[model samples]
Every structure is written in structure tokens, then in C-alpha cells.
Target: ARVMVAMEAELQQHPAQGVLVVGDVNSTLAAAVSAKKLHLPLIHVEAGLRSGDRNMPEEINRLATDAITDLFFVTEPSGQEALLREGHPASRIHFVGNVMIDNLFHQIGRLRADPAAGGRGAALRAGLGDRPYGVVTLHRPSNVDHPEQLAGLVGTLRTLASDLPLVFPVHPRTRSNLSRFGIDLGPNIHTTTPLSYMEFLCLWKDAEIILTDSGGLQEESSAVGVRCVTLRDSTERPVTITDGTNILAGTNPARILDVARTALAQPASGKRPLLWDGRAAERILDVIVDSPLFQPV
Candidate 1:
């Protein structure tokens, strides 16, 4: 509510031709509401994604943001289909590719140019070296909010860590829960505080596989063709599963292990989804410039 009020005040002071909001975060929904109320054109980027689980707050945000969106810039074909199914006109929806992937590619290019650019990346390599390892990141409320559920997932990581090093960049919530639940990550699992984007990219890009409950990680890992085992039951970004290296293992320990083993055995395919070619921002600009909202009345 605070964000909405502040956004409303800012827009009133100096209005934009259109208000753009990205992703399913709470701030996105707040800004979207403020734009609609002010009668400004609402543009939604990374729009039309649905995990079909109202239980997730992000799903509600996505639904609400798209409901009032005048222009929809989608990342995948699934987004196009989803919006059409929701009765949004086809002309209003434009498939512009994933801007997150654009940034991922950009950062990877920077890393390649200067390997020692980020001291954290160098520090990570000095410790872990070239040995094949796995990355673990868990923070979703579904995974970390409960003791039993968190224990089961951590135990799975513990078993995997026994064979090879698993770099666990623990989320603050997950770390707190670990202390609260009396769960041990085991000695084999290398636990660290959360990492910066470049530090994390350097760490996970070279890993043999990644175990995560993060939606962005699913897509990022897939972009590099690194096998990713998503901890959640469902994902809003289904393109990663169909075209990238992501496997949905949910919270089931047995299934996670099975998928992890399988993923480890297979080589990174390096396959990327269509239009993830680091030019999504350009396409978004093209759409915005051509749209009616941008035209002089």
C-alpha cells in the first residue's frame, strides 16, 4: 500500500507516457495498480506467466498485473498462449524474449573479458578449484518455512554432498530455518552466505548441476545448459523444462536424488530458448515505440 501511494504521488508529479512494470513481485503489482488508477497506459514485461498456484503470492501478482496491462511483453510462447487464454487481445501481446537472460549473457560476457573482475569469483575459484561440484539454493516459503519439509530437502542435499562438493549459498530465511529446525548441512556441504549475481554466476555456471527452488535460477542455469533440479512442484517458466536443462523434482527426496544423479551423468547441452539471445531489451523498445500509447495524439 505504501509503494502504491508513493508511486501514485510520483506519477502525479511527473507522469510518464506509460508506466511499465516487470515480473510478479509485490512492487510490480503495486505500481500496476497505481498506473491503472491514474489512467496511464500500463505496460507489463515478462508478462502472462502462471504457475497455476494461487497459494504462491507471485501467481496472484502476475494475475493482477496482467489484468490491467495495456501492453504485454512476453518472454516465451507460453506467455502468448496464456494471455490469449485469459482473453487478452492478441494485438496487445508481444513476444519480446527474456530480459533476464539478456542481462545474464551480458554479465557472462563481462566475466569472460575479465575473469578477475569480481574478487568474489576469484575467491570462489581459489577455494573450490576445477573439481566438478553442484550448487544448492533454497529459500521458497514452501521449502524453508517448515521443519519437516526443510529437513527432508536438506537431507537430500546432504546425501548428494557425500559424493561431491555442493556449494550451498544459503538464503537468509533458509539459514534462519536451519538454526531453528536443528538441521545439520553436514560437513561435505560447503555453506556460504548469499552471493552477488556475478559471484553466483561464476560459481554456478561451471557447476556440474544446480539444485534450487528459485525461478530465476531455473532459467539462468538452463541458459548455460547446466542441469538444474528445481525444488518446487511447479514452475512459472515452463520453457526451461521443455527446451532447457531443468528437471522438476519437487520436494520428494527420492525423486530429487534420482533426477540429480541423472543430471550429473548427462553432459551440459548448452541449449537456450528461442530469443534468449541478449537482444530482448531491443525488441521491447521496438514494441514500445511502435505501440499506440507512444504515438502523439
Candidate 2:
């Protein structure tokens, strides 16, 4: 909180001509506040997302950001509608698609070009050792704050590990919860530090199933044609659910295990086509460059 306040003060002192704040909804609120004070136009790249739970802080940030942002760069039609329903003028919302898709497409090409690709693949093969593996990541505070809920999630993973290995790239928050709740990670569960974006993309591409509470990973998993089991009770990205690429398993141990087993058994074969064509940044740039509001002083 102190850091955010300090940074905001600094930005206020020397405001840039155009400022774009991307990633995590928390910064959205800060951007909104900053825009109001600095008189700089704020562009929310992946805006209009709402988990519908104000207790989550992210929902609060999303609402606050959308309320004050001059332009909304949405990922899907639903996101656009969300902004509209919030009383934002239609002219302000532009469906520029998801930037994560752009990152994935770019990184996939990089991985192919790198000579270490073969070595990484080899390491993954050795680590997995012919065993089908599912990737799991849980970071939402609602799920991890409660000991019973956290234990249930871990139990579900343990049950799924009976058939296939569950690779968990443990987020620091989740690790802390595990230690706090005294939840044990079994032999079949492999926990590692948070992976780089490229490494995570490779893992998502290769995983038999992805069980996660992350919105970005859900989208990426679907883009790569991988089956995903969402651990949340509900999602802001309903496109994944409607497209049949992801299933909401909530936090129930039995349901998580059951849905994960089902997803692994019948993985989606054809890519269901991503919401964006990996040109969101370019589109946003075009909009900003062409808009009358973007004139240079």
C-alpha cells in the first residue's frame, strides 16, 4: 500500500503524455485514481472483468477502473457488455481481444526458434517419464484463506494423482496457505516455484489437463486446445465454459477430482479458436494513434 501510494505520487509529479497500465486488477483502481489526479487518459488493456464478488478486491478494482477509464480495451464481447451494463458509453469500449494470446503466440515462436527447445522437451519427458501429467495452480484468496477449503482442493489433487501426476507450479500465496493449514503434498504431486511465462506456456501446451483458479491460464489453456478444470465457483470469462473447453469444479474435493478425471479422459481434440487473434496490442495502438483524443501536444 505504501509503495503504491509513493508511486502514484511520483507519477502525479511527472505525468507522461499517455499511460497504459496492464495486468492484475488491483492496479486498475490505482490507475483510475491516478488518472483522476493526473488528468491523463487511462487505457485499461484487459478491462471490464468482474468475478461478481466484491470481497475479492479484484472485483472492486475492475469496477473502479471501468468507471474512470477513458478507453476500455476488452478481450471478448461479454467484456464489452459488462462495461456497457456498468453505464460506460459504448463508444468507449473497443474489443481489442486478449493480450495474453499475443504473448502465447509470440513465445511459442520463440520456443521453436531456441536451440534449447529440444533440451527443455527432453527434461519435461524425463521429469514426466511417460506418465500423463496435469498442471494445477491455485492462488485465489477465497479458496486458500479457509483451511477446510484448501484441504479439500489438495485432497482432490491427491485423488487425481492416483491415475496421473499433478504438476503444481505453486504460487507463493498458495504455498503459504499449505504451510498454514498443514496440508501435505503427496508423492504423486510435484510442486515447483512459479514458472516464467514461456515455461508455463510450454507446460500448458503439454499438460493433459489444467486445474487452476487463474483467469489468464484458463484462456491460454483453451487457446492451446487443452482441457481445463476451473477451481472457482464462477468465472468472469464465461466464453471458456460456453465453448466447452473448461469446466467449473468449484472447491469441492470430490467434484474437482471427478471433473479433472473426466477432462483428462476426453481432452478437447481441435482448438476451439481463441477469442482474440493475437493482435490486441496492435489494434489498441491503432486506436490510440488514430483517435482524436490522442493528439500530441
Candidate 3:
């Protein structure tokens, strides 16, 4: 109710002809619902992604958002196909590549240009220091929302930590759950507060491998040619698994351990997905500019 009320007030003051919501989240869903209630055209960026798991709330958000979206700016071929399969008009769906990659490319350039900007490089080097190590990040509700699952995941990581040093920037929710569940975050795994993007990227770029439940990490790892193990049964961004260096491990500790070991032992290789070039933001703007909704009135 609070989200709806705030959206209503914002739109009333601004009087937009339509709303364009990006990615799947509570905000995205709220905007989608508000736009439809206002009888305004809705545009959805990164539309038609599905993890095929009905239990995940993000999957439901994607479904609801895509249903009401007047225009679909997809990020990949599979997204276009997903929209087509669901009976959406192909004319309304435009494959505009990945806008997130544009920001990633920019930040990487900034990090490379000013190595001293964040002190990220030195911090990373000081922690791992010429030794190969793995990075771990887990924040998905499915992974950490429950007591048993969170404890199991943490315990598994603790075991893996003995094999190779694992760095984890703990999410607040995970930390609370660790305390609530009486799970000891063992010393073998290094834990820190959540890091800024540059600092996190610094750690990620130098890691031997990454084990995560994050959608963005999958794409980033694939983009930068790093080995990644996804801790989910399915991924909405299938391109990461199909073309990139991502391997799905679900929540099974044994499976995760097996994949991590194999990943560390093997020589690394990965292929970039189509149209992930740094100009994706430009393409998105081009579509929005040419759209009938935004034309001179």
C-alpha cells in the first residue's frame, strides 16, 4: 500500500504518458501495477526472463511485469523467444542487448584508470597475496531465508574453505540468520562487511573461481572470463550457462563442492553472449526515443 501510494503521488505530479520499469523487483512490480491502473502504456526492460521455478518470487514479478508491458526491451535472444512463446507480439519486443553491461564496462574502465580510487586492489592483494583463492557471495532468499538452508550452505563453505581460501562479503540478512540459527561462521572463510562495487569487483577479478546465487555475478563472470558456479537449480539468464563459464550447482553441498573442485582443476574458457557490447544503453535509448509514446505530441 505504501509503494502504491508513493507511486501514485509521483506520477500525479510528473504526469508521464507511460512508465518504463527495469528488471524484476518489488519496485518494478509496483510501477507496473500503478501504470496499468493509470491506463498508461508500460515498457519493460530485460523482459521475458524465466527461471522456470514457480517458487521464486522474482519469477512471478517477471511474469506480472511482462504481462502488462506495452513494449518489451529484451536483453538476449532467449528473452525474445520467451516473449514470443508466451503469445506476446514479436513487433513489440526489441532485442536491445544488456544495459547492465554498459555500466559494468564503464566502472571497469574507471577502476583500471585510477587504481588508487578505491584502494580495492591493495586490499585484495593483502588478503589473498599471490595465492589462488575463491570468492563466495550469497544473498538469494532461497539460499538464506531459511534457517536450515542457510546453515547448510555456510557449513559447506566452511568445509570448502579448508581446501582453498574463500572470501565472503556477508550480506546483512545472512549475518542475522547465522546468529539466529546458531551457525558459526568458521575462521577458514574470511568474512567482511558488504563491499562497494569497485572493491567487490577487485576481489572477483582476481579470484580462482566464484560460487554465488546472484544473477549479475553470473553475467559479470561470463563477461570477464572467470569460472562461476551458480547455487541455483535454474537461472533466468540462460545465456550465462549456455555460452558462458557458469555451472549450476543448486543447493546440494556435495554438488557445489564437486563443481568447485572441477572448476579449479580445469583450464578456463568462456564465450561472451551476443550483443553484450558497451553500446547497449545507446540502443535502449534509440528504441525509447523512436517509440510512438515518446514522439513529439
Candidate 4:
């Protein structure tokens, strides 16, 4: 593959004892394959995750990475069980919490320290003016791939927006989907380009409710005590749904609307899950230091 060749050349010049790949994307799979071919230790972060749906590219990426990685850094206990069930050696698995949450803590501080830099959040406030509002973010193709689905989903959100101002910070793919599907964001729905992380967190934290198809947002919402309605039927991050404040509504427009309504009526009474205390990066470093692969040549 093109990626493997590129990685091989890079490694040849600057040899590494180990290579670590984060998140389940094409790059992670490519790095894991290259590391295995080179006989170098591979560390996989946010590993041992599955949605039980092999049809999803991410599910396949996670499976392949776990199959070959020398060690795994996981976010939750379910990851442990998933790896164990797949016959992975228990000793190689390490639960170091959600590293993403560490970034969340850092960005929250940055947003608080400099409210002027609240990029998208500041602009949102200028127009919406702190009134009770909701947030909607959609990107996954399962929810918006087809014209019918995209139209239905947007129509539902438009209906919800009539009651409360809904800010949709659109992803590039979803923006294309809107045009391809010939759908319009109605008067009540406000759409903007993608927001910076700090701006997004600012918008999300104070939201009355959030309707999204994002796995990370589920965790982020739970950490900030925000109610979330996941537009997906299932999520790899089940901890957010079990201990945190996430509810899966599938892709059905009616069901999504219903879930959003329920979320708005209820309080964000979700508690932060275990090990989401903003020390994940520290724990990750400690694990890396202890690994024999990290020993000096």
C-alpha cells in the first residue's frame, strides 16, 4: 500500500523502537501494519473499542489495530472486556482513562482564561444572546448518506428549532450532504461552519441539550454535565450512555426528535465516569515509561 511504503521509508531514516497510533482512523491502521512488518512495538491508544457492526470502517480499523498492536491504552472497562473476549492477552491491556478528556480540561481552562478567544462561541452569543438553545452536530454517513435520510433528519431538526434556537456547527461532509440532498436549514435552525475546539466546548457546555452523532461529544457532554441525544443506534463509548448522560436514538427522525424533547425536559444529571478526571495523559506516560519497548537501545 502507498501508506506502508511511505512509513517504511520514514522509519528507515529514523528508526524507532516503537510506534504508537491514536484513534481508529486510516492512519492508525496503516501505522499498525507498518510496525508489525518492521517488527517494531506498536502501541494503540483508545484501543479495544467495537460497535459490533463490522460494516462500519471504524469497527474494522479498531479490530485490525488490536489484532497486531503490542500494547493497548484503553478509555473504559468495556474495552478490556472487548479485548478479552477477542482472545487478546490481558497483560497487554492498560486502562489509562480518556486522553481526550485531558485536552477537554486544558481547553476549558483556555476558554475561561480568555473569553475573547471563544471564537465561534462569542459569535453565537452575539446572535442567540444566551437564550435557551440546543446544539446539533452530524457527520456520520449512516445518519446522512442518503438524500431521504438527510432530508428527514434536517426536517426533524427544523421542527425542534421552532421551539428553541438550535445551533448546528456543520461538518464539511454534512454541509455537502445538505446541498446534495437539496435540503435547506429553515428559519429557526442556525447553521455555521465547523467551530474550533474551545468554541465548540463553550457552545456545548452551556447548551440546554445536544443532539449529535459523535462518540467523543457523548463523553465530552457527560464530563460537562450536559444531556446528549446520540443520533446513532449504538455507540462504542457505552460508558457515556450507562454512567454518563448519553441516549441513543438511532437515525429515525421521529425517535431523534423524541429523544431530544426528553433530554430538554430532563436535567443533565449524569456523573463523570471512572478515570475521566483529567489525568489520562499522565497515566498514559507512566505506562509508556514502564514498557520494556521504551528501554534505551
Give me the candidate number with maximum lDDT: 1
Candidate 2 lDDT tens digits, 47-79:
887778777667777777777788888877778
User: Going through the candidates in order, what is the number of backbone clashes in each?
Assistant: 0, 0, 0, 0
Over 4 Å off, model 1: none
Q: lDDT scores for all predictions?
A: 0.90, 0.78, 0.86, 0.88
Worst 10 residues of 2 by lDDT: 115-124
- lDDT: worst 10-residue window of model 4: 121-130
User: Which candidate, 2 or 4, has the higher lDDT?
Assistant: 4
> What lDDT score goes with residue 217 in model 2?
80
Measured with C-alpha atoms, the lDDT of residue 280 in candidate 4 is 90
The order by descending TM-score is: 1, 4, 3, 2
Worst 10 residues of 1 by lDDT: 117-126
Candidate topping TM-score = 1
Cα lDDT tens digits, model 3, 1-297, are 678789988998899978989999889999899989988899998899988998988899999999889999988888999999999998889998888888778888987898765465448657677788889998888899898888888878888889889888889988888888898878878888898888888778768899999988998888878999999999999998888889988898888888888888897677888888878879878888888877877
Ranking by lDDT: 1, 4, 3, 2
Q: Is candidate 2 or candidate 3 better by TM-score?
A: 3
lDDT of 1 at 170: 87
Residue ranges of candidate 3 with Cα displaced over 4 Å = 119-122
- Candidate 1: residue pairs that collide: none
Q: After superposition, how far is residue 185 of candidate 1 from its true place, in Å?
A: 0.4
Compared to the true structure, candidate 1 yields what TM-score? 0.98
Q: In candidate 4, residue 107 scores what lDDT?
A: 87
